[model samples]
Target: MKLKMHISKIKCINDLTIELPIERGLYAITGQNGSGKSTIVASASRVFFNLPMKEYFGDTVDGAMIEFELDGNKRSWHKKGKSWLQKQTGSMNIRGFYEGSLIYGYRFKDTTYEKLKKSESIDKAKLRPSHEFIRKNLGLILQGDEDYYEKLYEVPREYAKFDSSIFFYEKNGIQVSQFHMSTGENLLLSILNSLYIKNKERKNASKQCIIFLDEIELALHPSSLKRLVAFLEDMARQYDYAIYFSTHSIELISGIKPDNIFYIERYNDGTIGVNNPCYPAYATKFLYDHSGYDNVLLVEDDLAKSIVTRILRKEKLLNSRLVHVLPCGGFRNIIKLADDVTRNNLLGKRASICIIVDKDVKEQAIKYKKENGLASSCGMNFLPIESLEKYLRMSLVYNVDQKLFKRLSDYVFQQRSLQELIAEYRKLKEFDTDKNGKVLYSLLDTELRNRRTDRAELIDLIVEYLFEENKQPIQDIKKFLHKELE
Candidate 1:
């Protein structure tokens, strides 16, 4: 089952809709602070568990409503003068879904430890085994405790024993409970324990489970946050769980797939918008990140960056003091970063942003601009050729001087002519046709490495020769660089 939520007139978010697969995977909700991340989670919690709306959104719930879709069926809860009217329910396994928990503000403390110590609820003999997942992963979050073992401690109530008394022990039997544990340790243990207890109660392990964790990365080190994310990803896959976490951590976003990320933005019009499958760079709060460069050029990949760098170096603009060329991984990502930086003036008065993509994507860029109303003045432009790889290959096969060709023959072809190597390379059944020519680039790198030659230097040399042959586009880009620099 998948879930789609449409929220209207809720707190800072005037209107927003987010759809995500709920069967099994990790999903991230990311944005700048105060972009109504908590409100989205609260709304889902209210819909799924019947939690109160006033708990998240206070007295100003005048015309607020949330419409939800499970699979293709729709149901809505509309606010009517402090009361809510529920519509027809969807064909959902409410009991199966409700078995999962919504954990918000996951900050654990020693208060539980104090209660355990004061009360006579400790059940020493009725010990359950510590979760292997938690035991193996806890060390990754806590420093200098890689060899530590987790001890499951239970506190007995009148009817049953609660899994609240968690403890840890070192190799020498040095034990530490939640009272003595660090905040990160306490948080990790509490979360794992809660999940373990809940999941154990499930009658069917294959049933879809949904877990919502809001502000999931609070009060943890970046390294610990990364480890926790890895754990969640594994659990989500292994248990057929859909884990949705609302976070502002770039660390969290770095590990998540772009398609799984949803970026929430508060527009100037006082309404909220969602950018699903958002590029990680676009979701990053670069407005306040303070990149030291005065000007930045966003490109599709490292090859694009290399091409831009070669041109800038030739124009005397390659100095890191004046410009920084960064590869944003893909065409869409570079486009998103360009849009985000331009609209927000993210670098402010101290810096400027330019986007340069390969000419192969010129058509896509044109289509994107026509569809999205992206201004031409946003500084988006294309490289002179389809791509640097194709250009370099053309130069290598046809345009290089005999002296350079002889060097290539000696190093890349084992002293054979380029023709012979080309014939052999083309005969391979699975010739890579990747637009960026990644496989060709790797082959070139390996060949140069075998001959004890620097691949980058050879590429730079090829780019230099190509510049002499292609001056018009080079000059045009130089002018673009000059304008951005100023």
Candidate 2:
């Protein structure tokens, strides 16, 4: 059911690889604007038809290659100049079924309905299936509204310039043409009509159907969007269909399984990256939803969060779906938050919360806990080292290989010899936390801002060194938080 795709040298997407479910499931590819979500959909759509490369990538594209696997065979589509070449399967069945499966709501603009209105020919028979589909599905979305079911009539159509002139019935059975419908209603009708029409036209030519709907949430009311999502879920299951939605709807993305959601981002290096099984909080930039997680590990900063996450992953104790490592302000705030959660049972008995701070803050955390009469079950823990920066510095001196050390020095210190830089860094007053003096963590953060080099990547190298040089400290933290696994 897993379909792996790799697209390289194409438009804004330099190189991107993603995995999608090809069998039967609803999947979403979402991200901020210009992250290549639509481009990915276009690439996948090209597999089914001979689309012009110029349509998507404009006039200039250094040769592009898109590869995917179908039935244990690797198939590729290559684009050079203005034309596309395909790895021929010799049979037209798969392509034939998929060619009619793409639906773009934007394809139906106000002008389109205007054209439909002037057409003279009427085709009541061809409109029956899609009209019935919209009536039944729309009724579900408008469940409490009597008007939707009692007054709305089956869409009637007259064959038009493009395809058909669609009409809707309102209260008193009054006829309203497609041009008169609200944008949300028009969008919904266009989507369902296209889907039903395509499926009907295919007529079970293939056992599985793949649909790519771009910007599916365009102009839909939030309530209608939710119901449409549920309706599509049912449709996906009823018929063996793999439906792909390229959208920006948080409501739509949040409801999907983490593995089925793909988050796309264009990094500073101008290459597209796709994070499959992306967390909903990450995709929407709304971190408050911890409803599905069983445990939350509160840390002082993102670096600490990365360190804890890396350790848990290294020990095989991390399941991202269940555990959330959240960076919650400073040391004082994290301690206070943990104490409050424990004393008030904020997360209830079913969820576990743990506080982890740097080793340097252990004394202060202990003092605060005693002053507030914090419970022992508050689960206070500390990193093995004084701070992540100090630990990373130590690792650079002793643990890392020449290649990695050089890379780290080049990125963080701006090509300054790390030994000299570390000596100077140690001499500064309040070097660990001073903002004016350019704290080591702040320097690393600047690298992130300037180059999009994530702190997580730096943490990966540091944790890799920790796993080899010292792993017991990580094991101890994992042991203290074992209630999460329960």
Candidate 3:
């Protein structure tokens, strides 16, 4: 059985729709954060599977309408709420409408009984339905339900007459104990469980099953992610099961078969839309350019791309044909993009990635890079949001000492510039009650005796200080650079 979903009339959306191909491959949902990608999935689940929207999403201004295709027939479902569910003052309504002669009288209310009857016939007569039958044969693994906490040590088998589990990696630590027996053992165990279930169902059944994984990159190491994707693809072929997932990771999409990939975008009005890049017109153009690129450069956001591009051009590294600087939009995209590129041979062995994220993401970014064997690139760089001033100073080759750095950081936090900061310091110095302002002035005066370096190097030092601290070997040099250059 295959399921295709289309959404409309949801909150913040005027007319957003998506079509999920029910083929034996993976489908990824991707977009920027707060773009309503998750809303689309949640809406679909609520309508088609009769799942509660409140459990996953709060009440919003509007309800959703979903259209689905099962077997060769089409059906539609509608959902509406009086107020956002979180307000705890509204009621939600979900109703189904069926189309086509085969299911003319069928409706959502009758589906349970209909499924029971169908299953009874199959079980009693020991007869097999056609492999393409719609309702009774599919399986699902939601984002956070992969591992059964109660079992603790057992993996669940697919099509085992048990409810499907949705696993959310960000909320639940990766269970690695059953696999690597290490820190992320819980995570590894979850992955193994998913694979084990898929294999078990394949061995027992003649019909194909569909698996939907939302945010598939969560809690997965790069190597583990790579392996999981490959295994899913192989399972699609060997077991005839179809896989669909959503991610913001650009790396996860790179180099995959165009026929298997789908792109999603949401509008400000809250509507969602889908794009199939493999369609003849779209595929042809991207295919040509896809071969022309080698390495991918990921940025934190679109603005970062613009800023970094200017800096790279200034540094004369922007002209290289071997490197391509593309805006991935966020850290998740960076990780996904890296995973996809490394797994695909189409990108080639020489392909490398550079990720430039903010200092706030330094911890997660460094962990991802190190786990993925990407720490050696010098390509993964973190720049503090507050260090833009440091960049401005370095652009003039002005040495920024530790005292200056601290002062600048404080100034930036206060939304002031260096000159403004100096002026304010002077004004406070006149009062001189505690002499804190004068002390700051004296510190800055003494620290400004060193030679200045490039802005990029200065930004790197600030990031290292905030994130890597004593763990990084350059801490001493970074301090020396700041003290001597200022």
Estimate, for each residue in 433-467, the C-alpha lDDT of model 3 and write its tens digit: 52223344333333342323223343444444434
Q: Largest lDDT belongs to which candidate?
A: 1
lDDT of 2 by residue, 167-230 (tens): 4555554656556767666666666666676667555656456777777566677787888888
List candidate 3 stretches off by more than 4 Å: 1-3, 11-14, 46-48, 60-63, 80-152, 155-188, 204-207, 268-271, 278-486
- The lDDT, on a scale of 0 to 1, for candidate 2 is 0.65
Worst 10 residues of 1 by lDDT: 95-104
Residue 33: error of model 1 in Å? Answer: 1.6
What local distance difference test score does each model get? 0.65, 0.65, 0.45
Count of backbone collisions within predicted model 2:
0
TM-score of each: 0.62, 0.55, 0.39
Best by TM-score: 1
- How well is each residue in 281-314 modelled by candidate 1, as lDDT tens digits? 6667463444666888887655566778877777
**Ten consecutive residues with minimal summed lDDT in candidate 2?**
92-101
Tell me the TM-score of model 2: 0.55
> How many clashes (backbone N, Cα, C below 3 Å) per candidate?
0, 0, 33
